[model samples]
Target: MENRSHALMTGFFTITLLIAAVLFGLWFNRDRVERVPYMLATTQPVPGLNPQAAVRYRGLDVGRVSDIDFDPKVTGQILVSLNIDPDTPITRSTFATLGYQGVTGIAFIQLDDEATGSPRLATNSTNPSRIPLRPGLFDQLEKRGKRILAQSEEAATRLNELLSPANQKVILGAFADVSATANAYRALPQQLEPVIARLPALADQAQGTLQSVSALAADATRLTRKLQAPNGPIERISGTVERVGLSLEAVGNGVELEALPHVISLTEDTRASMRALKNTMNNLNERPQSILFGAPGTPPGPGEAGFSAPTK
Candidate 1:
């Protein structure tokens, strides 16, 4: 009975200690501990990307993924729930990116709180958006392989069509026509050999002609300068013009020989008329012809005094 009591006491103490330790641990961790809810939202099982996975806010343990579920209508999209601290107001600008912690490929939820002025997310919202950033290489490779397979199928169909007898004949005919055309053009260079050979000589002749033209242009320029110099044809032409002007002035001022004779005759006729008038006036002055005559038949004869005495 003593041994039994001792054994019972030891077991009781041990059980009590274990319970107290558990209670103390719970009390100590209660403030930091969080409950994460889980839901099957995604059509595909994102294993490591679970609600119980750690939700880091800017590398701090701010929250955890709460649940994941799929909509009844939409395919391939997983609605994820994140349970963040109530005090942590996540805004609309807040982003959630699915990420892997390490090489272990253990996926976790990373909430980007670095975005400024983010609004808080509602808890009752059924649909929560996640940034599509963590598709694995296998997923990308699978999509790429599907696209390549589709392209290969199309190529195979085209190849089959092109390999048909009619297409094959057409391709052969095209090849034959190309070969004939090439054969025809093969002699074109040979036929143009003479023309090609004459090109260099023609170019040389053109250069020579250009040089000769340059020499002739220089000579013409020199001749133009000579003609423009002092005592050239221009100066000679000016001198000739001056001389012609002087000659014209002299001719205009010179006396006319035809009018000289007429002027002389006019002067002689005027002098003669003046002399005749003077002589007539002198004779009239010398002879006083107021004689006493009878009224009907009195005649003034050579002896006018005799008639005067008879009249007296």
Candidate 2:
């Protein structure tokens, strides 16, 4: 009876301790627990994704994927449901992306929002609160890798084409031409020897011509300085021109050549009349009273020969 009582006491104590541990655990994790629902729709392959996968927003645990199923009406589309904490700000702009468990290939849901002040997600008849799933960084890198691989392949193909046998033959021919050209260049110094030998004579001729030119330039400089002197040919010429101008001004002040033509005409008329009177006298001396009977001949009129013109 004593043994039975001891055993019963031990069992009772064990049961009580287990119940207390359960209660304590519930209290400690109470704030950490959450279950807010959201729906996600995706058409892309969700590799390594499954129900109960962790959902994180900016690296903090916010929820878990609760279910995944294909929509009956939409081919190639899957409907995913999540249970997130109510505090999770899953706005209208919020989206989900696949994240990995570092080398494990295990995928989780990563939520992010870029739209500002957008309304919270809501359910519709055809679609639930659709937190659109976009390709993650890994998926983008994978696509870029595929593109790079294709480009590399194309470049290698072009390179192979460029290095084909025919092209190689052409390259060899070009190399041969280059070698011939190099040999020609190597012999150029010998070919230039004769021309180089004449360089000293050519240089002497050039020096002599330069000396002559220098002498001529000195002469020209001296002549230029003489012409530019204060009392040089230019000054003499200017003085001579001034004297000539003064003489012309004096002549203009004294001479009245503009009336010379009228003076000459009057003098000719007077001289002709005088000669006529002299001739009449000579005729009358021979004929005595012929003036009364009319002289032997009439005297000459004006502008006749023997007229005395005027002088300037």
Candidate 3:
């Protein structure tokens, strides 16, 4: 009876200890799995990311992707559900991207935060809480690789066409011509020796010429700047012209202009002298010496006929 009691007691104690241990373990891990759900919708390719893949925020492991499926509301859109730590500071500014581990190519969710002060989002009653997903570096590289492959395909086709038999024949003919040209220039070394010998002097002259050109350019730049300065030659010349215009305006306003057509009249005595001179000239042919003297008897004083006494 005593042995039976002891054995029963031993079995009950063992069961209770196991149950207590299990409860303690559950209590210890209670905070470890306090996951908050978040949804991500994207049209971009998310390569190699599977459920249970790690979700990293700023490269630190936070939680894991829980599920991936197409959104029922939006056709052709992928919805990735994540279960992150409740304590994660996933504000409105937080973003998620796909990432790859270096050599393994294992994809994960990489989270980054933008510069915003928005509050942390809570699970919506009507809809799953959503986060935005942008294209990752691997996505960009894959797209660029596709483009490069397409370009390479086109280049390969072009190259095949370019190297066709007929094109190759033409290229060979061109090569032959080039060979003939090269043969023609077989004596070029001897001919070029003199020219090559003078190259140093030519280089020196070129250097000097370039130096002169540089100096000239510097001078031209200086001249241009001097001409363009606010109080430079252009401004001074304009000022001088303005001053001259003002002076001319002042002079024009100060001076008085005279009237036109000032005429002088001949006097009566002068008219009488002219008449006497005309009569002398008329009788000049009759007696040439009368010019030095006067006409006989004062030319009969103006209008009377010449006094000749009594003509015979």
Candidate 4:
């Protein structure tokens, strides 16, 4: 009976061990899938990333990063394999980016769903697009601060060189010269005020002289207009003066007093000649008709009036 109990106990323990192993196996395979015939048609490597990490989408485990290896043919190109979940659908525009998860700084792939209008990305595809990761603002600011510090150090060195003894002397000398110039300029106003004050009196005197000159000019203009008046006394005086001038000019040219009798005689002779010419012309005009026909018998000479040249 004891031997029979021992056999039964041993059998029970064996069954329990098998059951435990099976449960453990089921638990382990919960996250693991059968190695399906997945293709690695394309792959992209992100720098500064670990290959053993899992690729996640919205905090869900989507794929595992398979390996990191340099391309044998393409120098400087790193190829990474990602074992994607067979159920996870990605589009042609789907891309991979690397980022740190939480505070560990361990990099992971962030798979994005881009299947809205894009075709499904084929599996086992090589040459998947690599999106460059951008540093955060704080990281950028840190880098910028380092650069600024370096520049500031350089600028300080340059400034220190410029502020050496010789440069200090030059700057101080310039300041001294500027101060002396300012002092001289400040004193000049005191010396110049009297000179500037006299200018106003000089200006007033000049203005008064100008006023007197204007008044004189106005009087001159009035006198000139008076002299030009058409029938004013000035015009008559001008005419008398002109006549006197002509008389003086004539006398200077030796017009003699004795020539007056000859001139008078010529005038009288010309008058008589003019009268005789007029009489002669009058007679010549009338004599033709009178000769052709006797004078129209109007009591011709008192003796012949009644006969009248036979009244022809």
| Alpha-carbon RMSD of each model | 17.2, 14.5, 18.2, 17.6
**Pick by lDDT: which candidate is best?**
2
Instruction: Please write out the lDDT profile of model 4 over residues 1-312, one tens digit for every residue.
Output: 999999999999999999999999989877566321122223343445776687776568877776777768777666666766767766666655566767767777776654567776554444443433334334567789999999999999999999999999999999999999999999999999999999999999999999999999999999899888889788899889999999998896665666777899999999999999998778768776766775564556657636555554
Model 3: per-residue Cα lDDT over 77-151, one tens digit each: 999999888888889888888999887978999999986677987874356688899888877888999999999
Report lDDT (CA) for all predictions: 0.71, 0.88, 0.87, 0.72
- The list of candidate 2 runs beyond 4 A from truth reads 1-32, 115-128, 192-219, 241-312
TM-score order of candidates, best first? 2, 3, 1, 4
> For model 3, where is the 10-residue window of minimal lDDT?
256-265
Model 4 bad stretches (over 4 Å): 1-48, 51-150, 206-312
Write one digit per residue (lDDT tens) for candidate 1, span 1-312: 999999999999999999999999989876575533222244444656765677776687867666667755787866776666656555556655556777887887665655676665454445433433344445567789999999999999999999999999999999999999999999999999999999999999999999999999999999999888999988889999999999988776665656777889999999999999998777566654523331245567766755544453
Compared to the true structure, candidate 2 yields what TM-score?
A: 0.61
As for lDDT, the candidate ahead, 3 or 4, is 3
Please give the clash total of every predicted structure, in order: 8, 0, 0, 9
Cα distance off (Å), candidate 1, residue 310 = 66
Clash pairs, candidate 4, are 39-124, 40-124, 41-124, 41-125, 41-126, 42-125, 42-126, 43-126, 43-127
The positional error of residue 268 in candidate 1, measured at the CA in angstroms, is: 35
Show model 1 residue runs off by greater than 4 Å. 1-51, 58-61, 67-81, 85-89, 99-108, 117-185, 238-312
What overall lDDT, based on C-alpha atoms, would model 2 receive against the true structure? 0.88
**Is candidate 1 or 3 superior in lDDT?**
3
Q: What tens-digit string does per-residue lDDT give for candidate 2 at 1-312? A: 999999999999999999999999989866556466788888988999999899999899998888999988899899888888877777988888999999999999999989778887665434446788999989999999999999999999999998999999999999999999999999999999999999999999999999999999999999999998999998999999999999999887666675676789999999999999998788787899775776566555569866566679
Compare the candidates by TM-score and give the number of the best one: 2
Clashing pairs in model 3, backbone N/Cα/C closer than 3 A: none
